[model samples]
Target: MVVLKMKTISLKVNGITKEITVEDNELLLNVLREKLGITSVKAACWRGECGLCTVLLDGIPVKSCMTLAVETDGKEVITAEGLYSDERAKKLMESFVKHGAMQCGFCTPAFVVTSHYVLTKNPEVDGEELKKELNGVICRCGTYYQIYEAVKDAEKYYKKETKS
Candidate 1:
């Protein structure tokens, strides 16, 4: 008889503390979407080439599919759902919609997450610098210009929001 070993991981997901038991080999993407029902973290391009599984791990953008579930133990994670609660993120979403940055909607969440990370880290980044910063996220719909514009506008709005 073979006994499978399981690890219990407790991590904060979208401002909520969640404890889940997972196999040693299980990926964070699976646990998030399957166990916790956080579908915003997509498993597209399991090899991490697509950047569709991007999420904020300890306030830093990371690919969920490539991270092991056990590695997230006692860590902080924020998905698109969590971002929605932030004022700056809401403004960013509005900017994306206004600029038509999303088409198929499959990659919007990842882009939004990345944009929030970039803008929060460097509020003044613009032009080619902004593009290079967000190069990790890939939108198959060819909405780069729209995404850039939205991010640019969002940076301004976010700055304004923080001022008040």
Candidate 2:
């Protein structure tokens, strides 16, 4: 009998370092939601077109569905929950709630992840450019207006140095 080889990957998720053993072909989305109990990284659109599976890989927005679990070795993988520890993210979440950005909450995590990156990286981005940056995610609730407002409102916090 042949044994399927499993690879052990060490990575930081939601500010916690975890070592998980997974099959060589497992997707990061599966690893996050199934093996790691990170349901915020949505499993929608397994084909990689949906932004519901978004996560921050070293502060850059990435689609967890397309990323391989083995590829995350030694990397920092942050989910929506991970953002809470950072002041900038907390403000953004507040803005999202204040603006009523999320309806179903299925795709909100991806928007939060993407918007956080854009805002923190460049606090002065205009509406058009900000829209471009957030164009990757698909929101079925048609809450783009509120989402954009949330990101825009959160820009004020990004202008300052956030506390860790």
Candidate 3:
């Protein structure tokens, strides 16, 4: 008889270092929410389409549901919780709130994570480019228009902040 043991790995999630033992088949999203107790990364469409499980893997947006737990070993994973205090994130949240970009709140985390990637990568992005970048994320609450507007406004906010 052969026995398989779960692998223990270390990862820095949301700026915190954690060591966890996970099964080979475990997804990063599950580990994050269940094991690490970080519920900000919501699990919606388990399939990579919802974008609700989005997270920052070394500053690039990735679908946590499709990512393997072991693959995050020794890497940095930033969740929506980590962005709560970030200036850019603050601006995004403010814009979203003021522009009515968030409705049900299920998809906001993904949009925030994805927007972080977009705005940080290019603060000068126009509405068309912002919409194109956010194409992969599906918001079931029908807040696409307001979401796009929020991203555009966030870009302008960040640009002004950086210049001064």
Candidate 4:
């Protein structure tokens, strides 16, 4: 009989460097929530379709559940927590609040992360494009309308800031 052992890898998560031993098949989401205590990245569909596990890999959104821990070595992973401190994030949070975009909160973190990507990538996105981008994320709480409005509002807020 042969036995295979997991390998330890070092990764920079939310600007902090960490070295963790994980199974070869371990997903980044598990390692993040279980090992690193980054619970903001939800563990929902695990299949990558839900986008509930979205996290920023060097500033691009990637489904953490579908990403291998080993593959994240030497890469920077930013979760919803990282965005909480950002100025744009503050505006987004305010919009979500004003629009009542958050219901159960299970999907709020993912929504926020995805919206952050949308706003950062194209701050000029219209309401239609905002809906398209948000379509990638699923909110079982049925807060779609509010979510869309929040993203659109955040886009306007961010654009105004950049132009000022």
Please name the candidate that would achieve the greatest lDDT relative to the true structure. 1
RMSD of 4: 1.7
* Cα shift from native, residue 75, model 2 (Å): 0.4
| Model 1 residue 149 CA deviation in Å | 0.4
TM-score of each: 0.94, 0.94, 0.93, 0.91
Score residue 65 of candidate 1 by CA lDDT.
88
Give the higher-TM-score candidate: 1 or 3.
1
Model 3 poorest ten-residue lDDT run: 153-162
Q: Which stretches of candidate 1 lie over 4 Å from their true place?
A: 1-3, 161-164
What are the RMSDs of all candidates, in order?
1.7, 2.1, 1.6, 1.7
Report lDDT (CA) for all predictions.
Answer: 0.90, 0.89, 0.88, 0.86
Q: For candidate 2, list the clashing residue pairs, or say none.
A: none
The window of 10 residues in a row where model 2 has the poorest summed lDDT is: 155-164
List candidate 4 stretches off by more than 4 Å.
1-3
- lDDT by residue (41-117, candidate 4, tens digit) is 88877797988999999888889988999998888988888887788888898899999997888898889988888
In candidate 2, residue 31 scores what lDDT?
90
Compute the lDDT for candidate 3. 0.88
lDDT of 1 by residue, 52-140 (tens): 99999999999998999999999999999999889889999999999999889899999999989988887888688888878888899
lDDT of 2 by residue, 17-100 (tens): 999998878999999988888888888788878788999998788898899989989999998989989988998999999999
- For 8-89, candidate 3 gives per-residue lDDT tens digits of 9899988888898988789999999998898889998899988888999999999999999999889999988898878878
